[model samples]
Target: MLVIGIGFFYLRPIIPFLQSQRAEATTVNKVKAIETLQNSDEFSKKLAAAALKRTAEDVEYDPGYYDIAYPGGDLPANKGVSTDLIVRSYRALGVDLQQLVHEDMSEHFRLYPQLWERKGPDRNIDHRRVPNLQRYFSRFGKVLNNSHSLDDYDIGDVVTWSLPYGAAEQAGSHIGIIVPGPGARSGEKWVVHNIGSGPKWEDKLFDYEIAGHFRFGPIRESMTAAADTKSGATLSN
Candidate 1:
């Protein structure tokens, strides 16, 4: 009886410590798994670079409200905003942001902001708005930190920043895609955006207060299988 009591007393004190160690181990394993998934396929990265490179030719910045078609609809090739750079880049990779955003907002309208007081999803401009895109990315894509670390921002990663001025009650938001730089800046990444001037590559990534960071590809289950084939592991959505 003494032996049994002593053994129970010793084990009882260490049970919580063992549990804590197990929890730590589990977390470490999960992080490693996600790390494996984070290294995306090279094709997507190359496609994003190629698409951003094409924008430098003549992408004029224009933020006018236009009534366009749904699904594959877009502004004129010459005119676009910061979000257009992202939309066009993804479109170059066969991922239609317009259709994807519309479909997601349609199903989860309540999840998106009702800033315009609109009752339903507006396909004409919902996909073009920065806030909407940010929310969509948060819901489906891998949400990243707003850290100063360059390693966190990868080629093909989507980043959002807040502008000083804004329309309506909300602060203005801008979005861009990470791409390669030139000359000395080549080692560090640059951003492709249409911040008033037009679609251009600049090393102004940390210029504004970063609002959101994301990796948005294959967010849905159907897309995950195809993504896994190239990435060699399942990515976190």
Candidate 2:
């Protein structure tokens, strides 16, 4: 009877211990799965999309060139221009274009255009400029050929265009990020930009002459993966 009692006591503890171990194992697996998904390219696209959506929520459209601080500085969230869309989208992915562009411009100031006519790199406005971002991405990112084919660009890709303003043919640069999902127009991809109005997702991929096309970070790899997926499906079929 004593042996039976001891066995029962030990077995009861073992059952709870095994249950705890199984729960711990399940938790570890769940965490691992979450980490894997977070590291995927889809996560980056989702981050950019969320950023664009948030930007679109701000109805105020202020284009004033405010003198701001450096590094992590920013104007009022609601008050910004086209480049702010790019800055905030990439910022959502934890890729601070403001700091990245400022650092790059500081190292190679001469490489960037002198549109603002500033002597050196200004962190406050350098990243906020479309041309500076174009040059920065061209240098650091995979600069895709500016083509009319929509297949060339993918979600998370950055595109620039020239906007002529005023007389004397003074052209201004505009930038935007491509996002997935339904576009404003059927059979067209959506773009998040602040063109005069606040940030919005529109089917303006070819609205202006594409001055630059770039795949920054892991966007290119994601495009390749998507392409591979399509190819694999075709082969299987």
Candidate 3:
């Protein structure tokens, strides 16, 4: 009885320490799991790099309607919106989101939101809308859980947020692509978006209500074929 009491008294102080160690281990395991599920594959790395490259461009925040070419269409390089940033990034990977979204909406018109009350798909402006892009990603890409936890996000992941009503020109919804955090925030992840000024890499991942999170890698077979064609080579069976 005396020995038991002595051991209990001596071990009491370290109990909290042991509990903290267990908690830390649990956190590490969770981080590992997130990393595994959202593993930074070659496609993701290239996409993230493409997104990072947008930070160097001088683009104006413009959402005006323009009749651009079909398939490989794009607005002027100097003008774009948030979705434009995403579109341009994917284009860098030889994936034309404008054409993909337009084609998908044409086939699955009912699957998209009718907020705009459009009679049919408008390829010119459909892919540039945040809701359309959200639906497209949900349908074709991997939709991830939305949470305030920073660990839930990773490079190349796409995040959508609900802005306050009448907040700014981008009042309804906003989207951004996750990129590696900048200098001081090196350990954290940042988002590349054009809120108003232009394409920017900022630490605003959890600034608003997270609506959707997505990870989209280009279709491998198509991307490979596109690359081979660009390099003046043909794929062999």
- Model 3: how far is 168 from its true place, Å? 4.5
lDDT of 3 by residue, 19-52 (tens): 6654332334333423442455677766777777
**Candidate 2 ranges beyond 4 A from true positions:** 1-40, 166-170, 183-187, 218-237
Scanning candidate 3 in windows of ten residues, the lowest lDDT window is 227-236
lDDT of 1 by residue, 72-141 (tens): 5667777678887777677655566777888888899999987878899987778888889999999888
Instruction: Tell me how far the alpha carbon of residue 110 in candidate 2 is from the true structure, in angstroms, after superposition.
Output: 0.6
The better candidate by lDDT, 1 or 2, is 1
How many clashes would you count in candidate 2?
0
Off by over 4 Å in 3: 1-41, 168-170, 220-237
Alpha carbon lDDT of each predicted model: 0.69, 0.64, 0.76
Among these predictions, the greatest lDDT belongs to: 3
RMSD of each: 17.7, 18.0, 11.7
lDDT of 2: 0.64
lDDT of 1 at 173: 82
What is the TM-score of candidate 3? 0.75
